[model samples]
Structure formats: C-alpha cells, structure tokens
Target: MIRPFAALLALAALFSAPVLAAPAADAAATPSWSIAIHGGAGTLQRKNMTAEEEKAYRAALAAALDAGAKVLAEGGEALDAVEAAIVLLEDDPRFNAGRGAVFTWEGTNELDASIMDGRTRAAGAVAGVTTVRNPIRLARSVMDDGRHVFLSGAGAERFASQRGLEPAGPEWFATERRRRQLETMKAERVGALDVEFKFGTVGAVARDQAGHLAAGTSTGGMTGKRWGRIGDAPVIGAGTWADDRSCAVSATGWGEFFIRAGVAQAICDRVRLAGEGVQQAADTVIGEVAAMGGDGGVIVVSAEGETVYSFNTAGMYRGRADSTGTREVAIFAGD
Candidate 1:
C-alpha cells in the first residue's frame, strides 16, 4: 500500500540514525596509596619479653610506620616512603641494623640492604658494607646511579664514598646488647645460632598515589655469620621485589631458604599469572618455605593496595597504614 518513494525514505531514515557501540568495558579503579612494614620474624613469645621491652618495640614500630605514612600522605613516591621508614629503624639501636647490628664471627658488623622500584623494575643492593651510615640510603643511590644492581664488600663502601654517603666508624655500629648476644652465641659453640637472634632485619613496602609500588630491606646480616655471608635481605628476588603489574614484597627470615624459594618473585608471579589474591599467594609461599625447614615472614602489597603479612614463625614485628587513616602495629603471633 506504500509508495516506492515512501519506502525508500523509511530505509534512509533507519540507516541515518546513529548507532551506539557497546560501552567499553569499565576499567578497574586504581587503589589508594598504602604502606606496610616488618621489623623481623622469629620465635617471639609474649611471655619471654618484659613489659618494658615490649613497649620499646611497639613504639619503634609505630615510629617506622609514621615515617612511611607521612610520605604516602604527602603524595611522595613509594620508594622514598620505604627509604624514610627504614632509615629510622637503621638509626634506632633497638633493631639489628645500623647502630644495633650484630657482630660477625670475626666480631664485626657487615650490613646488607636492597631497594626496588615497581614502575621501572629498577633495583639496587649492597652486601658486606661495614662503614656506610645508612645502607638503605646507599642502596637507593646505587639504584638511581643506573650503573649496577649490586655492589658488595669494599667495593660497595667505595661506591658509597663516591656517592658522598657519610661513613660511620666501627664503634657506631656496636651496641652493648648486640655485643653481649654475640658473646653468648660464641660461648654456646653451636653450629646454628638461636632463632631469637635472627629476627631483627627491617623492611618496608609501599604503594603511592600514582599506583606505583616499592620495597626495601636492611639488615646487619646474622649474628656470628662467617666468610662474608650475605642473606636474602640483599638479594633482589629473595628479600625484595616490586612490580606495577602485580605487587611489592619485602621478606625477613632465613635468607638461605628465601633465596632458594625466590619468595618475593614467587608471590608476585602468583598474583600476576595465576590470578591469586595477595594474601593467598603470600600464605602459600610461606607455608612452602616452612615445609622446607625455613622460618621467617614477608610483607606484601598488591598494586591495588591489598596487603598480607605472612610468616611461619611464632611472631613478626609488623605494621600497616593506608589512605583511609587506618594504622596498626602488632608483634605477637595472634595479633
């Protein structure tokens, strides 16, 4: 009943109408900046520690958290936040780094530290450096220098000097408590030192407002360590790793086992390729390490700000802070 011209007009109108393509899939929202830290993990027992000792430890952890949290709150890079937090711990005589570093078999301090940037995958590390005031700061210098990922022994000290990092004398690193502990270990004449002495390495992981992640670890190595021993704390994939695609990790535990397990990288791989959550990945890895006769713990932060503190030991000194003003510090295993 319709004329041919009318039919042609109807078709033209139908074709002329704009068609909306299906809306593009919504992108995932970036996470708010967050930070997490660990003093160390070992056979810590509440009954074994005095009230005064516990208070001192808790206060130290809080101060470290504040240092990193301040950086995150002010929109600073995650790398700087981690560095700031570690510097404070390194300066404090309470922890087994810097001023309170444990003595080696030769009765001297050998420091180790590493730092990583998730955005660029850049990393820096130093091992067996005796005189650097803050090994974490020197590690950052090595990272920013862009020439090498690791430097060790006298070479690291030379690099520190070249970078103008201040050097501290041997006396600056020897604390009376650490000296007494070393003496006790020597008296025991045991093949392995007590696990209690092993828990003192300090580490931090952070996510910035820009969605970047960074991780760092610093330690005085192990008490009575011999032959220039180096632990996972100075090893990139073992003690520290950060990647924008997955997560940032800082580990403190048995360095030998952590190195074998590639703890940091393993955690990220689980998150990146297996679609596992941060906590699951960390827990699984820690369990595996425990099964292998290693004890320790790790702090992890995903790109989206999810965090996990996983350890097989009795306790780990840890804390967390986020953009929402949430902050917590804990030391006991149940806590």
Candidate 2:
C-alpha cells in the first residue's frame, strides 16, 4: 500500500489538474446560452406563400434571434432577453401580436401578453388591452410591480399608463391584412372558425449564463374573437411558465385547449419531476393537445440549456440561436 503522505499528495495533484477538453460535438450540443422563439402555428403551406413572403418571414425571425442573442451574450437576464426578442416580433406586422393584431368581432384590436421569470417563479399577464405598444413590456412591468399576476381590459391599460408604458392609438394596430381577415369572417357569417383557426401568437424562451430561464408570449387572439375574448397567451401557466426547477415554456395554438391542458406547466412538470428531456416532454404534451382536437405548438428551453420545439400543426414559424454560433430559422415541419 502507498504511504499516507504520498496518497495525500496524489489526491491534491489530481484535484488541481486542468480540466480535460470536451469533445467538439459534445461542447456544441450544449451551448453556454440558448434562445428559441415562435411567431405562430397554423396551416402554413409553401404553396400558399409567395417566395418574397417566405423570405420576409425568415428575415424577421432571424432579427428576433439576433436581438435576444445580443442580450444573452452580454450576460443579461433571460427575462430581458425574452422580452427583447418578443418586442421585435410584436412590432413586425407579419406576426399577430402588437402591430398586426387581429380584430375583435366589434372591429377593434385587443392584445394579450404574459412573462415569467424562472429564478423567482414570478409572472405577470395582461389581456384585452387595446393600446399598449408592446404587451410584453407591460407584462414585465407588472411582474416587477410585485402585485397581481393577471390584469385585463381597461384596468390593465390603466396599470400600463401608471407605469409609463408606451401607448399606441388603436389605428397603430390596424393592419390591412387583419382587416381582410375580419371581413372574411364576417362575410362567411360564421361566429367563429371550426377548422380554419390560425393560432397567431408570438413568444420566446431562453436560458442565460446565470442559469435563469424565462418565457413570454404575446398575441392578438383569434381573427374574429368576440366578447372580450382572451387566449392562452396571457394566462401564465397555460401559455407561459418559467421555473428554475424546470424549464421555461411559451405556447401557441387553440387557447381553449391549451388553457384546459395547461400546456406550459404540463411540459415543465414532466421535465422537472419525471426527469424527461425537454423535447420529449413538449412532444408528449403537444400530442395530447392534438388528441383533444386542438393543434398548436410550443418553444421550450430547459434550465440545462436544452431548446425544444413541438407542434401538431402543418407548420410553425420558429427560430433558434445560441452562443455556439448555431443559427436556424424555419417555417415548415421538417425544416
């Protein structure tokens, strides 16, 4: 047997030695930081989109990724990064959150958004707000205010004003495309869609260098929603959830099913408690939504920095970027 002094010296050296380099592939598999975002999920088909339309969409997604990545690279909080990405998407009229929001049955715009911080498990949401420039920012403000988890209608707007949040006129949200969609719904004389629902929610999820996770989602609700309708986007556990113990999730699709299924929290429960991978948890949850006669998608980022996207629709406008120089943006199923 070795002498005790020699054994002690050996142990010291072993402990002080430099760490071995991980394999390149393994290192790449796990980035120092990661972010993922989605514009919406629906019956998106290549044939229905023009080449220019596809190009514009890809560019918009890429821009959102850039905004979020810049923050994470500078060691920003995941909550801020998520808000940054979503703000860009909200301003882009191609998506259905802020500027391009769909119209209510009464021919007006109503916006909804929610944000969660995994480190503290704090969240805030606003629904049926008409004039916030970016609902995601208002959501962040609400979360920071330390009171109330959800706010709605004129009350939410008053809270926004009190917080000095940016305000926009209703006309700022009235896009030509949204008007056309509202007209289509009215001409068809259908109160709501049975099969032609385009789930137009925009969202982001991210993990920062500090290991904090955050998620945020913003939406204009459905094309012809009525009676001050609110979708999953503004419901914390349904459309958005973040917990340091699990992952951060932002969901888009049929809000009713998502609210009933509690999609975001469901994904987190499977991952946090059951030791399931992020993608596996997301897939299982999305599959259940489909079985329930609803279809949509979610983007999730785990505490361990794993990014996942799961959807049951034909396509979801999605993108991801990480510290490892990996960049991806796609709208099709396989892409």
Give each model a TM-score: 0.90, 0.90
C-alpha root-mean-square deviation, each candidate: 19.3, 15.4
User: In candidate 1, residue 307 scores what lDDT?
Assistant: 65
lDDT of each: 0.85, 0.86
- Writing each residue's lDDT as its tens digit, candidate 1 over 1-335 gives 22354443332232221111111122243347889999987767798899999999999999999999999889999999999999999999888888899889899999999999999999999999999999999999999999999999899999999889999999999988888777877776542235243467999999999999999999997888899988899999999999999999999987888899999999999999999988888888887776666668899989988666887666788888787656788887677
lDDT of 2 by residue, 27-74 (tens): 447788889999998767798789999999999999999999899999
- Best of the candidates, TM-score: 2
Instruction: Give model 1 RMSD, 1 decimal.
Output: 19.3
What does the lDDT come to for candidate 1? 0.85
Worst 10 residues of 1 by lDDT: 15-24
Clashes of 1: 0
Regions of candidate 2 where Cα sits further than 4 Å from its true position: 1-28, 190-197
